[model samples]
Target chain A: MSDDRIGVRKTYKLAIGGAFPRSESGRTYVVRAADGGFLANAARASRKDVRDAVVAARKAQVGWAAATAYNRGQVVYRIAEMLEDRRAQFVEAVEAGEGVDARAAGALVDAAVDRLVWYAGWADKVAQVAGSSNPVAGPYFNFSLPEPTGVVGIAAPQESSLLGLVSVVAPAIVTGNATVVVASELRPLPGVTLAEVLATSDLPGGVVNLLTGSLVEVGPVLAAHRDVDALDLCGVPAELVTELEQLAAGSVKRVLRPPAAALDWRERPTPHRMLAFVETKTVWHPVGV
Target chain B: MNWEYAPAPESRAIVDLQPSYGLFIDGEFVDPGDGSAFKTVNPATEEVLAEVAAAGPADVDRAVEAARRAQHETWGPMSGAERAKYLFRVARILQERSRELAVLESLDNGKPIRESRDIDVPLSAAYFFYYAGWADKLEYAGFGPSPQPIGVAGQIIPWNFPLLMAAWKLAPALAAGNTSVLKPAETTPLTALVLAEIFQEAGLPPGVVNVVTGAGATGAALVAHPGVAKIAFTGSTDVGKGIQRELAGTGKRLTLELGGKGANIVFEDAPLDQAIEGIVNGIYFNQGHVCCAGSRLLVQESIAELVVEKLKARLQTLRLGDPLDKNTDIGAINSPVQLEKITELAAAGVAEGAERWTSPCALPEHGFWFPPTIFTDVSPSHRIAREEIFGPVLSVLTFRTPEEAVMKANNTPYGLSAGIWTEKGSRILWMAQQLRAGVVWANTFNRFDPTSPFGGYRESGFGREGGRHGLEAYLDV
Candidate 1:
């Protein structure tokens, strides 16, 4: 197949902690486009992949969090720059796979990159707008601050693939969260490509892992998993939001529904830090001063 | 599961109007261990209904502890079948005394006796009967292999349909083997208090369904109470947001069923007479004290004039007088405050340039009554169109196409309910899909069933309250 117009082969694996690796299960599933074109035989991530992702997230979370907020912002901005450099490729690929015009494809990719820049700026500043010092009755000087909600399980949107996937992934990670996102079953090429970008970016391994497979087979596994802290169900099927909502409540994990089609995504307000996550800390001081 | 229709004769003696009251905690009624009594008025007659006990933080603590104790040893471990039996007994007793309860509801809630008898009372009994069946068949509810009760629930109901709202809150909680400390709305606490009596007569365990009569302070106390495991509230959007904010940090489980400025859209293809009737029932039902009331009418421009004309002619026949009278249709505005709100919003509509009209219905000199009112030439941004008046006032607006109707209907923040009056089945299906409201009533306005899910979206609040979905509020998955 390496003749004049034949295609070159490449290996597809799970993206974890900014690296590509084979599944621990050594299983694979063939991916096909809507037209029945063979895309690739991608590695099927196992439960072990979920555990490793959690461990990697736990490892990187402290360092990522301890870094100055401005520094994190700078790192996030760098990814946006990388996305901008590869803009034409994304536009071309989105048009080819999603069947949109070049102009719309370009706008889609640009919006995705712009969202990274937008939320990157929010990484440190959201706390200022969302939390405050409360005049709660009694005792010590009390204040509230937003904290990461740990590992989030995201079901990336099925259509408007590029921009939708970026919108969900950036918000979770920008707030110091790690994510294991299940790409769309019918349109996952953009997600897998975006994962390649993250693999080369500053995102720590396992901090953002991308998986491509059947959502019906995989969504319940992520939902019922005790280790998952929160869920961003952007692309979840309508018939299943309630069931997933019920399961996510087991640990009181914060669950956000997908925005409606008519919702003004560009104008929608960013949720306050305290609104999305909570921080509970215990401070011990001498009783007698 | 049996529903009986009985004429509820006018009665001013069932309710003993008093000056003030105290909290009902444990099994005794006491002045809030903190002295604050709220004024409760009969919505039908602008009369001071009673003084209700406003529970303070301390009282909330006591009530929560009592509920916890009750659930811990008394009610929690009871078999599902046993819970069902108690609910069945409660349902039977409610039916046996349906007329008295209906009269009490009409008096306190200000809904016409016809609705109180035919709609509210029967529906309340239906909720109890339906959930009673589910008490032993929870596995069939699709929860999972295992579903458990989320212990003590603090429920807050509204004044619209006092007894029905209480049944909505209590039946599911009790059927799921959960204890509740329920706070009835300050204006309509009698039926809920009577419901407590029914529980007592049915030999229900103490604290299984405690009624604490109070206003915002009491509701806040219950919602903020730490000992309570879950909080379920049915009220206004503003109060719902406050509760959501208060529960922000506590990680307390919550389910909110709040306000809705529902849109009842009528297309030219609709059955004109039936659509007009639906429009009347949509906004004028319970004198528009419903959270899901169709306060905004989006009439297709092709027949806008005809629909308004028909709607106006139908409004003339609606009787507005004593709520206890079986023939009364529109009845009285729930209270003076609600009437004032309706009057203020209606005046604001005229001030904002909407053509205002009212049916020539006479009001009693003693009660707080308002005629069924309509406003035309209303812009999408008019307060009468945008804001919730929560009374018998409808703002009329015109749309050109299906897309425009859907757009105008879903423009508001409240997504509780929408009514699509069209004979085209395909059009209703399409509109139902596009309109984002939780409940979509097609060719019908206020038709409700124990099997259908009902609630709101966005600011109208989260969580369903009826059918299989209602179990979510009481379940620990």
Candidate 2:
């Protein structure tokens, strides 16, 4: 009897501080395809794993955010380049997890790479787009500049794993923020693979840290972490949004709630997302020498 | 001068007063659930204009429910073109009724008729027109290709610039397809109440625009209502902070246009005449009930004494009292409580060791009034300099260098606006950069256009109120 060629199995692990490692808790949870088939064992991240990821993000934030906007743009653009070269791998992972047709899955992979390029372009232009010189009634030069909001915690989308994850994660880092994301709980392989790509993209270490597991276990840890400056509650469980928001308020963390259910991720984005993750800083200098 | 001029009050006959007013909900006049009512008086004459119903918590809930229904059942389902037509209708009706509205606004809010007629009424109409055009073009406004509305906005406007502030909040809300429950300040609800009639005539669907007039308790109820999708407030910083704290976990969108103690800096090289004119328009306009009023003057130390002398002379020429008077430069205080607050703060300037100067003008005996006053010998730490009195009171400070001028201008927590007057083009640009205020008026003050974005920073609150940026506040994006 002839058998189909055996495909090589891949290990799914957490990527933090530029390296792939299992959860510090040494625990793993099985992720499955929509058809109830075994996909892979994703590292079940604990509070300790979150702490290490935040430390890496915090260590990497200053260097990444302070890098010239041009350099950052090139780094993110390189991520799209890497994503393009490995398109088939992402396509297979997206289909296994989403149960989408092979063509639809390929489109999703292509869209994710395109989104990275979109954000990469914004990296060099955000300051100009959001900043302006004010026409004050004075003899002074006043300008308001948009600055990166530090170290955001992302709860990436659960269903449209690759595209949605890329949508939320890229806008943030391209604008000079570092992120520690809890990738889609049900389907995290594509995200972990993207993190591997990020590791080699000349993107600084800890600039994009990915942990895969039960969001319920890791979400509260990231939300309540004092060091985390912002929380993107996009993929947080509906029931936990308000409670996590309450916890977020303790630190006055800038919170971006999930759009009303009707907001489509596949549509071309506007200027809103980048502006949401930045703070306007107005600086005044006397015009007279 | 008092003996020479006869009574020049603009005809109050133009304003058709109603004996009483009910809360405007779902496109109809309805009584408050609690049956509570308060008298709205003309501050200039101390005569009751009408008895307006005061809203209670239940009333707020009812208004929110109406707004939600309108948002879902009507406005939300309506085409953007249909919404644009409604806004356009409102704008046209406002222009037709501008004269009557101006008289009512002047009577109710104690702002001069000239200002109410030219500035407030025209601007109110202008906003409706400006935002009406934006209704159908929201896709180009940059939120998204198909931007969606956040339903049921709760807006609380202050007594100052009552109709214009209402227009600022309400016009964009409706244009963006969000229904709103607006609470006009109790002291000045007549024009806002009149606006409800305009909304009804414009054929805006039920629950799309509800005006509930009340004071702090009513405003608090509206702010704390769970049904509200967003809260837009233009009032005190203390109350703004309370709203911020109350909505902490609920994740309601909030935009505040709060109090400000803005600085008007005058450089020595400035055209002194124009600088003085800007200073006068800055602090004394609308009896100084403006969040962006240039209440603090930072004059170059070399020219400080001259500026003060000219400012004092300018004050003496200001026509105070009778808001209905077309010639009135400053009008009666809006209310007794506001008068006392102003009185106490002006006294505080004296107690705080700042030399005070009042314009030599007689205030009307029966009504609440305060003469235009300025305090000299003021430092940055003085109470008069540090707090927003919200009256036509100015404080003078001197700085030898532009650095000290910018430093002192930005010393306040309020960054609503600042003024820079200098001859050099580069200097104006440079000064505009350093002043942390949201609206910077170079060689101009107290200027607002429906097309220009306006709001404050820090305690002054968040969100721009006009231009394309204002559209973002009402949209779900």
Top DockQ: which candidate number?
2
* Structural similarity to truth (TM-score) of each candidate: 0.66, 0.75
Q: Name model 2 segments beyond 4 Å from true.
A: A1-120, A123-255, A258-270, A277-289, B1-6
User: lDDT (0-100) at residue A68 of candidate 2?
Assistant: 90
**For residues A102-155, could you state the per-residue lDDT of candidate 2 as single tens digits?**
999999888888988899998888887776665544454555566677789999
lDDT string for model 1 (B111-207, tens) is 8888988988988988899889889888776566567899999999998889998999999998888999998887888888778778888988877
Q: What is the DockQ of candidate 1?
A: 0.03
Cα error, candidate 2, residue B250 (Å): 2.2
Stretches of model 1 off by over 4 angstroms after superposition = A1-289, B1-9, B12-22
Kindly list the per-residue Cα lDDT of model 2 for residues B1-477, writing each as its tens digit: 443467687897878898999999988999999879999988988988899999999888899999999999999888889999999999999999999999999999999999999999989998999899999899988677799999999999999999999999998999999999999998999999899999989888989999998889999999888899999988888777677667766779988788899999999999899899999999999999888889999999999999999999888989897888888999888999999999999999999899999998988877888999999999899999999999999999999988999989988767788988988888887787566677777776776666566776555766778767788899987
lDDT (C-alpha) at residue B59 in model 1: 81
